[model samples]
Target: MSHRMERVNQLIREELSRIMQREIRDPRLEFLSINAVETAADLGFAKVFVSHLVTSENKKEILQTLTGAAGYFRGELGKVLTLRHVPELAFYWDDSIERGARLNRLIEEANRDSVNPSGE
Candidate 1:
């Protein structure tokens, strides 16, 4: 990615976070976090990666809510962003944080086994 694209991605992420915090009133979005934003080279669309502290049971519902609100988010972006065109937002559930925690648990278990060696 070029420097300009990086800047654009960062700007979009920040603006989206702000919008979510101040504008969105959905209870499902209370603990949501915008993990990252990846915009296409032509600025036509963006893939927004997001996560929440809520249970996995609510993951599908949360994603659905975010996807349904994409248009509103884009409209809000248009009002704040100076870009020639506001990219279409696509919401995706990001599991990187969960994956990292799982990986850490595995590593710790491996270390414990290494020390014990014989299941004592």
Candidate 2:
């Protein structure tokens, strides 16, 4: 990312954090963290990635809820952060945490197999 894009992404993250905490009345928005933001080169759109601390059960419903509130979130972002263009905001669930957990489990299983090669 360019320096300007990085700066803008940081500002968006901060402003969204504030909005999520103070402005959003939706209970579905709770227990979530704004993980990252990707702004298009033309600044016409932004993809907001979020991570939820809650269980993966019903993860699809959670993502649906967040996406449904995209317009409200974009409005909040525009209100809090003054920018030439507040790009259309899109929400996505960041799966990095889940990927990391899966990788760790695989590594652990490999290590255990190496330690006890013979079948018990």
Candidate 3:
């Protein structure tokens, strides 16, 4: 992506985060945060990745809520952004945190094994 697209992606992420924190009243989308945004090269679409602070049980419920509010979200984006065209927004769960946690556990295990040269 060009510098302009990168900046726009960041702006979209920030604005979406702010909107979730402030304006979105859907109970299902509660405890959600914008994790990342990827805008298409043509700037016609944006993939908005969100993380749910809620437990795994509620994650699906929250995603359903977000999907239901997609239209409203796009409208909100249009209102909040000054762009001539607001890209179509697609919400998705970001599992990067879970992957990071798994990687951390593996690293810790490796470090422990390294410290104990002989398995006792």
Candidate 4:
């Protein structure tokens, strides 16, 4: 991506994060954070990755809620941005944080087993 593309991606991420925090009042979205945004080269489409402080159980519902809210989000984003065309938004759940936590726990368990070797 060129410098312009990178800047556009960052702008979309920041603006989306702000919209979720302030504009939306849904409880399901309260814990959501826009983790990153990937805009296409032509800037006609974007993938918005989101992370939540909430638990895994709520993930699906949160995504559905965001998906339903995409149009509204894009409209607000378009109004705020100076771009001639606002990219279509696609929301995706970013599970990297949760996956990392699970990996850490597994590593710790493995180390503990190596040290003990038997139930004590």
Give the best candidate by lDDT: 1
RMSD in order of candidates: 0.9, 1.7, 1.7, 1.5
Question: What is candidate 2's lDDT per residue for 1-120, written digit by digit as tens?
Answer: 899999889998888888888877876678788899999988889998988877667668878987888788788888877788889888888989989999999999998889997845
Q: Taking the candidates one at a time, how many backbone clashes does each contain?
A: 0, 0, 0, 0
* Candidate 3's TM-score: 0.88
Clash tally for model 2:
0
Ranking by TM-score: 1, 4, 3, 2
Error in Å for residue 24 of model 3: 2.1
CA displacement after TM-score superposition, residue 91 of candidate 1 (Å): 0.6
Candidate 1 structure quality by residue, lDDT tens digits, 1-120: 999999999999999999999988998899899999999999999999999977556988988998999999999999999999999999898999999999999999999999998979
- Higher-lDDT candidate of 1 and 2: 1
Q: Report the error of model 3 at residue 104, Å.
A: 0.4
Point out where model 1 deviates above 4 Å: none
Off by over 4 Å in 4: none
Q: Which runs of model 2 end up more than 4 angstroms from their true locations?
A: none
Q: Write the per-residue lDDT of candidate 4 for residues 73-111, one digit (tens) a residue.
A: 899989999999999998888989999999999999999
TM-score of each: 0.96, 0.87, 0.88, 0.90
Q: For residues 20-120, what per-residue lDDT tens digits would candidate 3 score against the true structure?
A: 88887777777787888899988798898988776556777777788787788788888878888889888888988878989999999999999996976
Give the distance in Å from residue 79's predicted Cα in candidate 2 to where it truly belongs: 2.1
Candidate 3 Cα RMSD after full superposition onto the native fold (Å): 1.7
